[model samples]
Target: MERAEMKMKVLSTVTVERTDDFYKVVDQLNRTLKDKGLTFGFALDEKDSNKITMTIYEV
Candidate 1:
């Protein structure tokens, strides 16, 4: 048996202020919507300490 490969596409990228509460929203969305083909992720920008790079993807 073979497993099907799922491809992810980046739908949006935005720079936003890094805050604890904001991450809570992203985490909630991922927990609730990931199986529905959408996911949210974030990482601190290498050049900025006060901002985060948020990416929305289609799974």
Candidate 2:
């Protein structure tokens, strides 16, 4: 089976509360995309003091 490549496009930008345990959120992001049958292109972390902004892109 061949895996389909995700298009280069901006999907959405999500922000989560700042926390020491960030792995959960990252995992969730991966799961969410997988559930949607989408591939992850890239993620940009734009974090501030109290929150983190993630710009998600399709692969």
Per-structure clash totals for the candidates: 0, 1
Task: Put down candidate 2 lDDT per residue, 1-59, tens digits, no spaces.
Answer: 34465354667867767677675666777788866654433233544567766666665
List pairs with backbone clashes in candidate 1.
none
TM-score of each predicted structure versus truth = 0.79, 0.46
Count residue pairs with overlapping backbones in model 2.
1
lDDT of 1 by residue, 1-59 (tens): 23267777999999988887888889998999978989899999889989999999997
RMSD of each: 2.6, 4.2
TM-score of 1: 0.79
Candidate of highest lDDT: 1
Model 2 off-target regions past 4 Å? 1-7, 31-47
